[model samples]
Target: MSDHPHPPSFDENILKKVEALQEKYAAMGQDLNAYLDGLLHADYLTYWDYINLDTLLSLQHPITPFPDESIFIIYHQITELYFKLALHELDQLNTSASKDPDLILKRVSRVNRYFEALTHSFEIMVDGMDQDQFLKFRMSLLPASGFQSAQYRMIEIRSTSFDRLLREEVREKYEDHAPGDLEELYSHIYWKAGAVELATGKKTLTLRQFEVKYDRTLLELAENTFEVNLRSLWNGLPVAAQTDDLRQALRWLDTNVNINWPLSHYKSAVRYLQRDPEDIAATGGTNWQKYLPPRFQRRIFYPELWSEQELANWGKGWVEKEVFGVK
Candidate 1:
């Protein structure tokens, strides 16, 4: 009864925030009252709903009833998700004008880590499945090869320009051409050579279908990424930001993606698909023995970052010894 004016029970900070929000909305010509009313009815965010876990789990639709088929589907889905996450970081790098060296290094390191994880976990393909089951069920997946992974291609495009991705023999020809001639440039990408049928000298249906679906999209991506590519972005950084740590990160990324990952993938193909005299043609009908080897493809993303000896021996020694048990 002897109380001076009683204080309100609610947080004063929250009340202040509401007032600030109201002022902010009003300044922007928005209806603050309506928004506040809607906020009153909103439920708290749940982890499952926020991530859409149910929908993600529902995406594993295996065409074959084979038990291991889901394993194949899920692992590829996981790889795609990882690729998407890497692309998210790349997209930020592409759009950012912050010029923060630490931030650039962090993004590059994150991408390098992603590729490293992919390179290491490729054992999931090499040894995860029963070889007989893989070879048997693969027949059901005709014209649908991992070669058609558009995100992998997008990652390559974002990493460097198209010429950097060309076969070594023709890189000079494409580099000397008009910069805007992406159509002509796209025609000569190393994969085109990979997908050409050996006897008939025609494009494989896998590559043809891939072109039909993604050629325009890839062209657009190439144009968008030409200047904003990771190499260009690194080059744009202030000279002081280009430290040894950054250079090592770039070189490691280049080697992991181009060499380690390719060698791992080629080993898996050899394990499950090779038949001695002639290896089995991949589902994409690619001459994989010729195409998959990094020594032949020489897909160096950051050529300026490597030394003459490193460039001369790209993926030659350790990969050969480790993958093939070569003396």
Candidate 2:
């Protein structure tokens, strides 16, 4: 034999794979040879091409010429992308054929990881930009606000019972409301309060635009995930699989999304928007004081996992230490 191994022929593994592909294409009435030819001609994917990096980089078209405006735009885009990843994990769990607690634990942990990454990266917004640049460029953007992030809303809608997302004021009233009344109940969703004009107590143009675009989609998601959401799924799981680790994972998720995440935003708001007794309105005219603080919303995803004290204190410690500097 030559020093090199004999030129390879179609080995058993290669032949088996080819046969499998042939059968796969045959089942769909496709010619495997045609696909093989196309595959042969296709260029190998590069990192940039695979991710559309150029397209993604080109997306941040700031309305103003300020350099920091790009930072603001890119950061929000990144936040939305992470929210999409979280929703992807939730979607898989919600639509799964079986309520596997291990899967729930795995997916929820993944969402937690995404949120933690976001919470840490939020430092970019908190300190990276010059406040003057952000304040000026933001004005040119008009009634658009991060509050309009539909994916974030979808994540909440798919996380728990629809009523959990409603404000405490109307939640009791609408908790038992029929599915047919989704639209009516949505009218009182907690986030709608976040976008009101502080002076007038009226819907800001930002909220109106968000509602018009997302209300139907959010309602549909709420209905579809009604029985399959995390809270409902946990309720239906067998006692054996409802392990302590799983409960802890969910509690972490609840804290990550509701408490830690919002407090980070509230921290940033205090950095950029906080003034003495009179603070500046956010670009979208949102009341950042009321909106960013978790103590105000008190939104929780899995309540049964938390105790009365935890619920009562909800986000109070973080606000005290980070925002108020009350060591």
Candidate 3:
């Protein structure tokens, strides 16, 4: 025998076979339409080979054998999946919004639907679990608060009223212009306000009609402008006005504020807390009473976009009419 022993017989044969197959496949036309069409209509058993649905479904794990525990686990798991998808969509929207800002509204509407589903799902969870029943598993979830979710944090940051630090972080990462950026964005608003004033010819239209018409036009402009801005942002491209960036940023903030539907959650928490104080203590000592603030109010995401005095006057008139039945 030669000094160099023969390479492993099986490995040599496999390598040869793979190379031969690669050459054969390469010789075939590049179009895979026929192969993909067959894969699409394959039976369930064969579907696993193409998509691995079995492996995906097998991921649900029940930590406890208790009948109710599975329901509890599955509900949260499903919500988590929804949250994941929402985050993915938001990121895609953000990228798209950067290039074509008009799409932001549509993207945000999609996100809103997910939030609605999340809100409804929570209601179902509360309805299904009694205070005592939820308590049994609540303690097992120590240090796993939803507050810690990074994706949720991203959603919150993008959608809420601006936090200076968070805004700075965003600007740093995205190459956004800072102080001048605010002025640029406000200029757009000012220009729009002037246009509204000019269009109305300073003639006072009834508040109801004015609001309806104004909102329609504003939303239309926002939708169109947002698409253009989004396309730019998505491709890391630059636009002339930094105000466009600010408006897009504020849109995310406004949507974030709208999505927080916390009042319902607070009420549900209170109901559960009344039933299972012990479970609450065991599951990380939450004081539901403290959690619920004395007065609940919706927070504004874009305070600068509106004239507070004008809004207050409108509110006063509306309240007077409603209270006095003067309408």
Candidate 4:
């Protein structure tokens, strides 16, 4: 005690933590001192750095001089981030070993919540931007369109079997191939029909550019998710887990993605771009009148879950009234 000053009595909690850390490192074939050295050099994490606030705020590089252009960029970036979040949940659903119903419901709920947010906020696109500026700036973005969003495509792939996402005609055509053939499966996806030239029925520059940039990656993703998609995973759940609540949740998710979101988006297009007599073509040069409306596409993610009437109704009456002003 006199020589070493009582050896500097340590707190019991601190001593216990140190001993636990030493044992943990020992079991892992590491030295606690080596980790302590690294910790000594580590910088304290800041909120800005932890969230990458600076880099995230720097992403909105609008081409035009209009202030609203930044809004457009930022909103799409936000949407993509939401899509990324949804994909994170989907990935967890796809990889889970147990296929726990509670977990699946939780994840699908998250994805639906994200889509619901987008659906509700699509008014930002319809009304937030000045029409004149949006029209003017849209010309600067020639081939790039929301249709080109690869993450959106990935979400669809993870949500259902590729066959369900295809037009029945397209599905029948590819029925000869092995069920999981990536190239064949993706060839029939419904979105391939979008962004086409109405006059010539050829692929639009928008579609061509999208294919060039994403076709390979999409094929790979489709291959990976072919058997593990949301519908397949849901079918794998215990019969008790397919309760009415869960069924309604899944149905809402299906309609949110395939109908409600698209319908809202189509309304925005109509609001901004639908000039009477001859509506302005979309920036992507598609027959968006045909492409954007859900009734014409009828892209259902889960077919067996819906009855004949629901399938027949699809996106019919409500969409016609809201989007096209039909009686």
Candidate 5:
């Protein structure tokens, strides 16, 4: 018969992959042919279905009729998504047995990129909203402040030593504390002061609500990440492996998160809430004046990474330039 030899069922590479997959499934006590049959019958994946696009679009149900509230909701949703990406990078390092400095640098670089995006994009929150609509609708969503973001708190916990997160006034008291002392330390966590009711000297309903939902979970994460958090990992790195690029990334991350981000919020607060007679109280009575400025918190994730003068001048220049239009 005039014919080329019948073509082999699959090319050599495909056949090799199938063989490897069969071996893999056999090790796991699976029937490879059954899995192959399921794959053969499966529908082609659509982009929207793969990403759950319809479900994601349906999540925003603004509590008030004000159209600007929709902007607020969507922007916060976008922020949480970015935070999720940052944590995903950190979690890989935290869970891995390898303390390879290059891996840490790679993940840190990715996280820094995410925060840079967030810091730049915060202009949307600052200037995009109709302040009148925002102030009107924001009250309807009272006691529920952006201060209640558990993911932001989780980023702090995952980023550095828990002691670094303590209020400056109380941090010295717990300077020599042990791991079991997390409860006491957490009680004085810096952000809590920001969430207090100005007149009553008590925790705001916003902070109280957040504590109920996240206290145990966050404490557990803190305990688990104690040895594996970014600061600890950086400290553990051999001096030779601590490249200048890595140091720069870490420093940029600290500035982006602690200074630039808070100042961005401060800018938004002044834009909407600052008034002629008396500046408006923020949602949930958050002490924005006390809370949003970096000079007050002075929360340095990596103290050893800075000079004494740098530490003294922390958050000062950024605040003057961004908040006050200083040169």
Candidate 6:
């Protein structure tokens, strides 16, 4: 053996080969680009040119000269853009659900992921802006709040029955004609179904019973909608490929149903309260904690999708558990 181990020799040939491959790849990319240019025509390029990145970026308006305000504005604006994109995707998904329920569920699950990202992003924003800095701009945002976000409202309206009821309640509070047309339509369907059942010597249902039945039917429809999506993902698969996408989608829906929106609303309220305590009393809006009612806590959008054991495993303690606190 030699006194010192010989160092490994550098392979100049190997280095040369790597450089040659890189050049070849670069040339191939250029050729591919030229081919794509020929295929894509001038209209696509003109459309691309129409995109005004500068104008889009100019929308960030900082009310205060505070350094953090810039950060705050950008972060929230980014979140709103994300919300817009998610709403677009959800709208498409909802349309698909009307036809291909399975595909829609997958898309809805993806949208839920976006919501999760937004929730986490808000937490980050809270951390970045100290209490004092947030207070400076908080007052500037008076009546204009996330509650007035049309896209958010649209999402809630399209996704849940809650919006319909809430709208009706608002209309009733204003002493306006109650828009019970939907309720009436539901009643008509239920009565028709009941008549068929009665003719077949089955139990006849009252209007109230029919309403409950309608609710259950809608809930089942939602479940079926979810299931159809889950089944599509499970298609073209062996046992191993059938992963927990369905379970994850269900969990996401459960989270949204139980906590997501309320949690965000609560956070927004808390941040506002932290900045201005007096505003809470003046505005007649309580702290975020109070907003989470017992009913809201236990709300599940698609309870039938979950089995008894799954509910127990999730520590939800059955459907009857109150919202604010464990019963």
Per-residue C-alpha lDDT of model 3 across residues 53-77, encoded as one tens digit per residue: 7777787776654566667667767
TM-score of each: 0.90, 0.91, 0.50, 0.90, 0.92, 0.51
Give each model's whole-structure lDDT.
Answer: 0.81, 0.86, 0.46, 0.83, 0.86, 0.49
Put down candidate 5 lDDT per residue, 1-327, tens digits, no spaces.
758997668888998999999999999999999999999999999999999999999999998889889999999999999999999988887755637878888988999999989989999999999988888888888888888888898888988888889988777787666779988888888877877776677888888898899989998888888888898888888899888988888888899889888888888987888764243654655566777789988988988799999999999998888878999
Count backbone overlaps in model 1: 0
Which regions of candidate 4 fall more than 4 Å away from where they truly are?
1-9, 96-98, 172-177, 180-182, 276-284, 324-327
Better-scoring candidate (lDDT), 2 or 3: 2
> Which candidate number has the best TM-score?
5
lDDT of 4: 0.83
For residues 97-200, what per-residue lDDT tens digits would candidate 6 score against the true structure? 34443554566777787777776666656467766666656656543344334454344434544312232224233322223434433232212222122224
Task: Give candidate 6 regions above 4 Å deviation.
Answer: 1-51, 94-97, 162-248, 271-276, 279-289, 292-299, 306-327
Q: Write the per-residue lDDT of candidate 1 for residues 1-327, one digit (tens) a residue.
A: 856788667788998998999899999999998998898999999999999989989998878767777778888888898899888887786666735667767887999888889888999988999876786677788778888899999988888878877767878777644458877788777777776666677888888998999989988898887778888777788788888888888898898889988898888888888854333543544577678888888899988899999999998986678678989
TM-score result, candidate 2: 0.91
Query: What lDDT is reached at residue 176 by model 5?
Result: 60
Given candidate 2, what's the lDDT at residue 40? 100
lDDT of 4 by residue, 116-201 (tens): 99998988988899988888888888878898999998999898877777765776566445555757667777888888887878
What are the C-alpha RMSDs, in order, of all predicted structures?
2.7, 3.0, 17.4, 2.6, 2.4, 15.3
